[model samples]
Target: MNDRVNEWTPRTRAVAAGRPSGPGEPLNVPIVPASTFVAGGDFAYAREEGTRTWVALEEAIGALEGGSAITFASGMGAVAAVLDLLPAGAGVAVPTFSYSGTRGLLDHAAKQGRLKVRRIDPSDREGWAAAAGELDLLWLESPTNPTLELIDIASLTGGKARVVVDNTFATPLGQQPLALGADIVVHSATKLIGGHSDLLLGLAVATDETLVAGLRAARTRLGATPGALEAWLALRGLRTLPVRLAEQSRTAALLADRLAGHPAVRRVSYPGQGTMIAFELADADTAEGFCASLSLVVHATSLGGVESLVERRARWAGDAHVPPGLIRFSVGLEDPEDLWRDLNQALG
Candidate 1:
């Protein structure tokens, strides 16, 4: 990676950081599908060394997050790598409301005697400060999944434990957790980073060399390496992340304000930034009706794609804690008026 590229703005760095800088080199990093290399080279086996494609993706993401990054086969893979850093029966503090996949993983580990898990609300500062002294890891998500709750990351760092922020929702463009004193930042590149929902990939970024090495080792041991093509695709998607997120966030803000005024919406959960919003109706039936009534917005799971998506949060058993009438909406690049029209008619 070029140290000089660090001088550029994040948007500029996003496009320029991972490109082949040498004269006559291809403008983009080509997919290197090799699993083995010739003797005496920097790379030997792909599993341990990684391919050029993965390196480029890591370089760009690391630059954006202000740390060194390691790619994984899936977002859960990255989460698992971070958890692997803990010793057996390690104590962990996590958000009571977070991505279900992450919650499920911690629950499974606790059940198997692999970890001691403590669940706390993301906004509970006192609980976090208390956990900081006793826990091995502090896992947090800001503008948390479905709920859009923000955490004071800087206030929660500098304790006995390592702080890991899941930046999947906020995105690096929205916030750089490392800059705010977080020990490590993780992302489900499958979401906003990939931008198109076409691939599965994850990343863990940290300025701490030891943690970075541990994450890499865990990826190798767990065989959670990302595919070469997926890396290349994510890189392509990343090139436009800044612009895409900006437009989507703008649309989200507009919709959030509009939804707050709608009689059908009891409440709107929007942090005033990012592309996600959650609104509540009268009941589960009303929420389902709103999703089914939409003409333009997709009624589906997953988020941060070019096309809007909406679903009743309580429809999923794992998310039963969320209000039965709550609708998790992922705003896209559609025209603000068009989206509002669709939502208005749906609410009626």
Candidate 2:
């Protein structure tokens, strides 16, 4: 359907919202992998062109977000599109512990003098409010990457600046930032939205049509667009997101609770919510050794998949601001007992 959608429960929306009319359709959105397309239809060209797979996923996600949604080549591409809206001198306040690509983009903006970017601990509501003047936007990454920090979004935003939550971790299934009073919601569809790490994609949703138009304009011009095949994969992922997330969340919490009291670990940070969790070792040497000891869980950086994964956040300078011994864990759909057994021995 070409018309926009409003909320139904997210679980309901994930399956129905984006499907297009077809000649005795196959029931699932078709993954069109074309860089070129014929004019005279809604999608003229693949560049300015649109894809059914992308639209289906966008509509489903947008419906849950209660806004217009757009696709990007990757999560950062989605970030770049929204950040592109800031004109010269417009300020952006982001948490210090954020995804590296986001920090890098803000740095580029600062260097170009196109935007003003500042970092604050997300829980500092008073600090964020005080810093809001002339700040065109605020970025929220709750239960932030690797650190498991929380940002009460409703508390951080002021009318003076727009708030955009990076809902990659919580996903729409776990939290609805817009419903919590955010102006915009962003996701690296590459992560939780896709559920499996098979494809790269990004999504942005905003209640404001004008803002969405501007984001689309940026995406269209920069050619940072998602492919139909990838969009379809994301849609396939969405169909099972609720079930996957619930299992992952349960396993993650089980592991987090177990790790916290273990003698080898010094600290744990789970945000006491959905799947992602972090813990700090006594030192980077211990942290690296623990990762090396793992047998079942892959020692890797990315999160949100069917298999458990672990990464040392401090390996990247962007997360350099975090504790040097911190380990970020992305819970998978494995049997909780298997993950618990593997992780406990790994930590030892």
Candidate 3:
């Protein structure tokens, strides 16, 4: 609300991050759905950069990440754009337990000789730092997907490589990667940032203007710009991100604590923050039944939504390293007691 935005808390930033409403203008930003802007103007085409709707969303996310931000059609689109920043023979290192889609993309690029991919254990800070010396890019996903294992991002980013951190699981409210020495911060806005599961969008933020320009050019060439409506929806969800994350995170911790004591649950993995909770059942066989019996929690694939979702992570072919019975639980806005009752019944 004031010139000293950095002095504000994350909740304050989330509620009021975007552009200010001009006098007589709509309180909320209007969606500019035009493919092409007026001739002889600054914005000649939407794909080249973005429209006002997208800019508003970018500014909001950027403000949270403490850098300039760009929106993409999907999370993978943002990932690809970052990868494109590297040269053909560049070496890159990524987490062994990162999001499967990003792993697959890196593997595909490796196969084509576009870049060399090295899968490094996230917990191995020494190995990561060693790789960073030779790598052009180091991609890290803290509290890795499904497993919830965390790495020392500051230590990893101290090396020579350009660091790109995926902060999707730990929303910008939970962790600011840019502040931790990372060169770039990325997020799947479709998840917690959107709060609702209705839209698909991604965001990348960085302090370097040249890198941001390159990412924007890559998005334009690849035609991976986000839709106006999706941008607008994501912006709306972002307005309440702090509130949703607060409730979801509190409920998730409660569920993890209770699940740790359950007989059927072998182990509960929580980073002690964020909305994601992973717990393992007896085996792969019991996982399906457990998921099937949940009355209130929806059995779904994606995480970070308004509704609780439970899914067996090992069912996906890409996540073989994960335990056979691991369930990636995404805590939502539901009451903790109600959620506990559902889990108790489901486990039974």
Please rank every candidate by lDDT, starting with the best. Answer: 1, 3, 2
Query: Could you tell me the lDDT of residue 136 within candidate 3?
Result: 90
- The C-alpha lDDT values of all candidates are 0.92, 0.83, 0.90
- TM-score, cand. 1 vs. native: 0.98
Model 1 residue 65 CA deviation in Å: 0.9
What ordering of candidates by TM-score runs from best to worst? 1, 3, 2
Q: Give me the runs in candidate 1 sitting further than 4 Å from their true place.
A: none
Of the candidates numbered 2 and 3, which has the greater TM-score value?
Answer: 3
Error of 2 at 163 (Å): 1.1
Candidate 2, superposed: residue stretches over 4 Å from native: 2-7, 21-23
Prediction 3 global C-alpha lDDT: 0.90
What are the per-residue Cα lDDT tens digits for candidate 3 across 1-348?
236667778788777767566588677889998999888877888888589899888877887889999999999999999999898989999988889999999999999999999999878888898988988999999989878999888887777799999999999888998999999988999999998999999989999999999999989988899999999999999998888998888999889999999998998999999999999899988999999999999999998999999999888889988789999999999999999999999999
Look at candidate 1 and tell me the lDDT of residue 104.
87
Please, what are the lDDT tens digits per residue for candidate 2 over residues 164-277? 899999988888888888887889888877888899999989887888889889999878998778888988888888888888888788888888889988889987668788
